[model samples]
Target: MECCREPSCRKRGRWRWRWRRQSGSGVNAEEEHGIKKIILIGTPNVGKSMLFHRLTGIYATISNYPGTTVEVFRGRGSFENQLFEVIDTPGMYSLLPLTEEERVTRALLLAEHPEVLIHVIDARNLEKMLSLTLQLLEAELPVILVVNMMDEAETLGIDIDLAQLEKDLGIPVVATAASKGWGIELLRKRIAEYVRKHGVRKGVG
Candidate 1:
């Protein structure tokens, strides 16, 4: 079932098995009405969807972006008493918009102006993915870094100094293996705290 020679296709195929194991019909009304907005952006196969499911406790509602075939996922979740509207954008390697999917994601980011933007990255490819993080920071967007797939990185003998990475990036960084449910609680805490401190809009009770 090779879709194409693109790396994204291969990665998506590799994780197809996990998709069947997922439960829940999709996002619910409570999750849909969150006051704060959190957008998850990352390259394909970086566990962005898995993290979204974890945060929202439901599968994302997949829909085509306006006037485009590209799909974006949206759901809602609560953390530390803060309700958040979470958007899992299509996989994008850069904000430069080489593909239609990237173009949609780039437009979504600029237009939504979310209270907290979470950039999920593969732990094994940290250095490579940091370029996008830098791009986000350069744009002056509120960003939080999620170093996902730590379990795989550990299996490959990669050790990340999360505190150091957080200091270097000058933003909150959370280490997690979203598939295994590791570090999700901490990630939730960080998201809640970040929003409370920097959120532009007041949370709706």
Candidate 2:
């Protein structure tokens, strides 16, 4: 009965030790402080709320359509033996800002200065959604663009080249169907790595 300050080596009833670092590589000083905060931002019905709930197990009044949640919700989650505060912001279309709720979302990003910004997006509408992704990149924020709702995209016969997208975007791009819990573990691991590292280098995914 031994315990360590890391993930349990018990996947699929087998013991497998996994060491997590601040970056994809090994070793970094940023791991000392742990993950202070992570903010989830996206447009309406992009699964930001769902992914937030899934990550933190905190309910934030989910609905079938948009304009349901007019406020932000914050919760806590633990990954890679590190604790993090997760914030769910109101839907926003772009960083340029327009609606009151959208402005509110932008305000949270500026105010909180989260360690990592998880941009959840609907994969079916990549062209439209990528606009905001571009904006986030322009701001020079540590952003991880999540191409969520992949299942819906598949149903519509919409195929996305994730590797190409990642290369083009110059950031980590994760394809997931948050509703079905696909690619979540990888997302978590990526987030943990970003937090542990000072920040991902520019001009590279």
Candidate 3:
């Protein structure tokens, strides 16, 4: 069996010591300890939520964006002994906000400054989604493109060259069928590897 290296699996006394130091005002525990943040952003009906559930499981904290009615989901996920705080933002077609949800999502992106910005796109609608991916890259955010719903795309005889896409985008790209849990493990491995190399963002306090 693989040995567990999670924070909770550490020595009790050491864990308590670390927890005490991480406890503070304003920031949450994850932020206090410098846990990396992963934000999922994409247009509606792109399997974004399903992908989020696949990464973080069913237990999630649903809360409205501060000072707005737009809801956001936050959950915890562990990959390769690294703990991450994953956030599922509202569907946004573009960085230029039109709807209130889009505005909130954009605001969250700026305020949170996540370490890894995951752009989940529908494999069947690759052309339509590439625009937003370009926008994200232009903004200089660390992004990972998730070509989700590959099964559907395959059904329609749509083929996506993930290797070529990754090469062109200059970032990690993954293919997944979120509903069927395909490529979820590879996604986790990629996330952990990305974080391990790039490290967490500074000034998160």
Among the numbered candidates, top lDDT falls to 3
Candidate 3: Cα lDDT at 199: 84
Clashing pairs in 1: none
The alpha-carbon root-mean-square deviation between model 1 and the true structure, to one decimal in Å, is 10.8
Where is the poorest 10-residue window by lDDT in model 2? 10-19
Shift in Å, residue 59, candidate 1 = 5.1
Ranking according to TM-score, highest score first:
3, 1, 2
- Candidate 1 lDDT over residue span 1-205, tens digit each: 2222343231144333322332253534333334578899999999999999999986456667777999878777878887777889989998899999999899888766688999999999999999999999999889999999999999999999999999999999999999999999999999998987875643211
Residue-by-residue lDDT tens digits, candidate 2, 104-204: 78877876667789999998888988888889999988899999999998999998999998998888899889999999899999888877776522220
- Candidate 3 C-alpha lDDT tens digits along 1-205: 1213444332133223423332342345444355678999999999889988999988676777667888988777889988787889899999999999999889878867688999999998999989999999999988999999999999999988889999988999999999999999999999999999988775422
RMSD each, Å: 10.8, 11.8, 7.8
| Models sorted by lDDT, best on top | 3, 1, 2
Cα displacement (angstroms), candidate 1, residue 145, comes to: 0.2
Where in model 2 is the C-alpha error above 4 Å?
Answer: 1-35, 59-70, 199-205
Selected candidate, larger lDDT, 1 vs 3: 3
lDDT of 1 at 9: 31
